[model samples]
Target chain A: MYLVEKLGEKTIELFHSIFEIVQFLLLIFLHLVNPKSYNPAMRMVLTKQIYFTAIGIIPIFILMAIIFGSVVIGVVIYLSTAYSLESEIGSIIITFVVDEFAPFFTALLISLRSGAAINTEIAVMSVNKELNTLKEYKIDIIDYLFLPRIISGIISVTSLSFLFALIMLGSGYLFTFFYMDMDFNTYKYLLLNAIELRDILTLIFKSFAFGFVIMLIPIYSGLKTQNHYTAIPVSVLNGMVRLFVAVFFIEVLSLIIQFF
Target chain B: MCENIALIKAVHENMSISEANTLAVEMLSMIGLQKIAYKRVENCSKDELLLVMFIRALMTKEKSVILKLPSEIIGGLFHIENILKDMRKVNTSKEIFVCDLVSSKAYYKECECHIEESN
Candidate 1:
């Protein structure tokens, strides 16, 4: 009886989560389709979100991307030489680093940083009756707050993923040039040749999907918070964990769609 | 509440920018807050904010308005009564719901319906 109850509870929770995500996505779609959604206030919110989520982290993101690219390239070079698989280096990097790691790491970074902040902020607002205040004013929270954040998240993640991939590719070339005596033309040719149209499309889709999930999960978690201070931390924790899982799920799904 | 007022006046009322400005000026003048009309809410006093919220809800022309009056405003019952009187002049048909603490029940003696909840 106890085991059955636990399973039922878990299943109910899962369904609730799916329902919330689908409802949020519908709200986002409605906000986008409605021309009135793009008011001056929403524009201000979008700009702020983009600044915080993307622009603020550029320096650290670049540094991390360079380090990651160099490490991956170093390993690939050593392994390829040992196994006499030098010809496959470009394909490995393109498939694993550019297509997968760029979006995955970008989502992970954003989930840890902005995701936690959004969840906590909204949770606190809910607890403090701020959301109720907005409601009393007849302000649609979805239009004024959630939509801008969601749109900004998608834009920021997509742009950052592109930047991350470009920087990583450059770093990979630099590492090979300095350590392995590989020519720039050869490295560029190999990478460009290995990258297919499908890979690029898959990367784009993954970034957008991952970005949507990261922002949506946090907002949903925050909204789930009751009018209690204790719920804020719990919401943030749940949002972060769910965000990480969602990002991985998106990455794997995109890869599977691309290959199979 | 101040934000709510601004939003409703600016958006829901379908007032043009200049029209909204004029309405804001008129409302602020009534509350003796014309000087601080354009100032940010963060800088406004509690009373000023509450007054703005009151005026905003009145301007919406909605059939019903529910306001949760802060404890500070409850102590100034006379001021609230005056605002309600002014609101009646502009909108006699509007139903106003003022949710307040049990200690603040005395101020709503003239209200049509009173529902009290105890903790």
Candidate 2:
């Protein structure tokens, strides 16, 4: 019941959904292959790209990481110290905050802000014929507009997630020392012991994929749309739902791939 | 025939032509229009006009709603006459509609979507 057969065709459409997933990968590849096609105002694209994904997300991502990190550190430190398992503190911080929570949380925050903006902005452009107008002016709309967004999104999500992960680690450290018997050196030792090259790679991939899926899905939905002023809202809603699903899907899939 | 007309009347009974147009587009599927395309007497190029016909076409559960549309629709023909020609060309599906009306004729309704039914 999740999907109604439009024109008696829901199952096949789901199959076609895979193509939608590949559209961004294709865009990125094409852009790289034909760099000359996008030679108009490359500076503007880069600036807007960074500004949208990185700068706009700094304040909120920092705040969330700080608060969430503090609470987590406080709880973990208290529990570990109380149970005399304080040595396990570093593993908990590395596994829970760094590997799992911080990256996902940062990705979610960036996704919601940047993803919604991409989706809604593209939809409005589609509605207002701005996309059409771009074509009229001999601009490669996808090359300049969407390609930069995709690139910046991946870069920003990875970097920003890394930054917030550090912030969370610091916050965790603060809570442990001030609120528990743990010293700064003990906390630092715990964290350093948990560091592994694979963990960082996993975190980076997850962040980038999350950001990529979020923005790409919306772009697909906006382009596939035909006039239903009503359909714009529906497309956006569908995009958001699919985005969250994709995020969770990546988490599970990555875990499987790593295990194998 | 009677069932189709009844459905149309029911679709248009208390609604304005514009309202009927919206209902027409919403109701028709691509297949439904394909099976009955040539029989369509009116070809609606304007989305507003096609929308009313589409709403009327789909409002009824009756299988023959497209074949007999007179009963469901009422007296707005005088004002909506320009659009009636396009109605004749409709195939009763979303493909042609999207190609002809939804994609080409889509204009942001600058005004409140108005619909009046004359029950």
Candidate 3:
């Protein structure tokens, strides 16, 4: 029984990878061709994703960022005051908010919002032959469904992350100013020239790629649906798994590219 | 039948009608171009499939193939020429284990026209 379960799991994983490859390529094709096949469906998907993902996360993200920021500031001040690194307070806040936390949080929030939702929706759509029917109707599926989501996901993720990062930075700075009483100008001096153009570019690139991959993997898996309704949940489940895997791999790759 | 012969003759020099359509559809599928539809697979002459495939390929790649389509008997011959260029790159990528599927003969002659048009 143990050996049989292992074999079954391995086979499923293998097939999942195969289907994902095919689906991603197909979507890429649809993307490049700018299919006008399904405008209404595309718009609907976009509207729904925006409302569910971008709308639902704002308050929660802000609150989480505040708590994380305050705690980090408390630690920074405690250590920096003792070590004579008080002047580096601003740099610490900026790095924590921008470099490490912002992107990861943005990706996480967006993943929860768009990744899970799109994967399930597409998987369901696929099992129903909805995608195939659109094709049969000669409606351009790319232009309608996928592209809109891509655009919306990028915008939504970017906007929300920027908001959360700002809140965290502000909260951290407030702690530094009030409790630590670090000189504000010294803190500014620490960070103003510290940010390189490359770092900014890396941040944008990382966020964009995160948004892209999150949407890409799930939708790709969803489109591979065979005509069985069970396949819907199964594909979505597989997509969720792949989405996390891609996110992890991309994060590592981005760090390597940015630093090395 | 003379009509079938005429249709086949009209298709082009080498590929039969069915071969070209299947080849065109298969090639499109191979390249991950799902949105590019194959409407009315039959009744296209080789020349027509040649024109259609060329147009479709160019469009799929987001190249401007519209003006070139009416330029010659082969219409957008530039489309096929570009495919040939990509095919040459495939040879180089093959050594690195990357599959260069786009550089195939689907662009060499519009078999789509020959097959589908003939059908």
Candidate 2 stretches greater than 4 Å from native: A1-8, A37-40, A81-84, A258-260, B1-119
> Judged by TM-score, which candidate is best?
1
Relative to the true structure, how large is the alpha-carbon lDDT of every model?
0.79, 0.63, 0.61
Clashes of 1: 0
Where does model 3 sit among the CAPRI classes?
incorrect
C-alpha displacement of A258 in model 2, angstroms? 4.1
lDDT of 1 by residue, B42-105 (tens): 7877666766777777767588777776556534665555555544444236777777778767
lDDT digits (tens) for residues B27-50 of candidate 2: 343213332322333443333434
True contacts kept of each: 0.05, 0.00, 0.00
Better by TM-score, candidate 3 or 1: 1
Q: Give me the runs in candidate 1 sitting further than 4 Å from their true place.
A: A1-17, B1-6, B9-44, B55-119
lDDT of 1 by residue, A99-207 (tens): 8888888999888888899999889888988888778777778877898888888999999999998998899888789877999999999998899887787778888
lDDT at position A74, candidate 3: 74
Model 3 chain A weakest 10-residue run by lDDT:
A35-44
Q: Write the per-residue lDDT of candidate 3 for residues A187-225, one digit (tens) a residue.
A: 566667666665566667777778777887887878876
TM-score of 3: 0.57
TM-score of structure candidate 1: 0.78
> For model 2, how does the per-residue alpha-carbon lDDT over A1-260 read when each residue is reduced to its tens digit?
43565744866787787775676568667775675634434334656788978998788778888998899778877887789876777776787776788778877887688887787778877887768845643456776567777777788888888898899999887787677757888778778997888788889888878767766777776776666577778778877787788888988898788678
